[model samples]
Target: MAELKAGVVATLETIRNHFPSHVITTRATATGGAHVIIEDVPLGPPYNQATTWVGFHLSDACPYDDTYPFYVRADLSRIDGAPLRCPPLHSTGQVFPADNSTTDTRDATMVSRRQRDQASFVFESPLSKLIKVLKWMLEQ
Candidate 1:
């Protein structure tokens, strides 16, 4: 099942004709997946404003097992980013935010960016690989 899923993603690259605008890159490239930043991607409805990134994951694990094989992820994340376009100052003619609203937006954006930068999404194998390792060791 995992192998089939991985194959589909790789096949998509071929189907898309290896279009740069059709792929997205990831921070981790252990599986040699394609990645790109795109603006207009078809998502069924024509009104969707979200950016789309479609790619495949290849299992890099050697001597793979079906139960635990190398897998590719057909994942999409919202690339929602708005510039801090605060109002400009009147006296200084500065491209600054005006009034308390501008200050508030700045504060909120800073907090959000900091939180996002500090946060990470990692799934740790919690079922205990040691148990499986022990079972394999005993068999050997």
Candidate 2:
């Protein structure tokens, strides 16, 4: 379990480095794997649609194991006043920044950049290329 958690941390760090403009937060899940929050990305009908499209492409490019180290989920309820829980200090659940702690806050710059990048990927890039890149990253 420790090894898996370490791997998850490493993978999250790599993803954070790759997407410097995006905000990445990690919270310990009851299942041992972490819930990675890609903050500032819009959630709802259209965004869910885009994620579904991406997931379809990703699934063909990589295997998804729901019981593995992690899984991607689209939680639209977050936009509708749901509070994000940060674990209490003594609890096994704890939150950490993917980057250095100082930069973890969700700000205008991060939000705008995330929105722009998401839009660009959904609209401008070819799905095949995106799939290839994501597959390559996962295989790394």
Candidate 3:
């Protein structure tokens, strides 16, 4: 297995601490980073599901690299039966969170959010991005 970088490990730890009740799983990437999947994350408000799994890749570059897109369960729908405001699943049947990476057939839908300013990643860690995305999802 590839070893996780210090930044990747530290970011994972932060995520775990913030979502103590949620189950966070990780798989080391070839480049010394890791794939993080947080299970049973509350979808709250407008969403139909009470909770869904959110996953993303933390490249070895870590804080220097933006986390970009995130993934949630594929079947996500609005509670009022309206069309989902977020990006829908692509033709590949998998959510593409990055150019060549996907949610690995977990049947997830991608939330294509990119930090407006790439330089801000130093201040906006992965955990913060995840929280922000979750809040945005809940409000949609």
Best by lDDT: 3
Between the candidate structures 1 and 2, which one is better when assessed by TM-score? 2
For model 3, what is the alpha-carbon lDDT of residue 130? 86
Give the per-residue lDDT digits (tens) of candidate 3, residues 1-140: 57899998888889899989988888887789887889998776697889999988898999788886788888887779987763442222455344454355477688877887866779888888888888877767
TM-score of 3: 0.87
What is the C-alpha local distance difference test score of each model?
0.25, 0.32, 0.78
lDDT of model 3 at position 112 = 70
The parts of candidate 3 lying over 4 Å away from their true place are: 86-92, 96-104
Error of 2 at 35 (Å): 0.1
Which residue pairs of candidate 1 clash?
23-35, 23-36, 24-35, 24-36, 25-35, 25-36, 57-72, 59-70, 87-96
Off by over 4 Å in 1: 1-40, 61-140
Error of 2 at 102 (Å): 25
**In each prediction, how many residue pairs overlap at the backbone (N, C-alpha, C within less than 3 A)?**
9, 0, 0
Give residue 20's lDDT in candidate 2 (0 to 100): 70
Candidate order (TM-score): 3, 2, 1
Candidate closer to the true structure by TM-score (higher is better), 2 or 3: 3
**What is the alpha-carbon lDDT for the whole of candidate 3?**
0.78
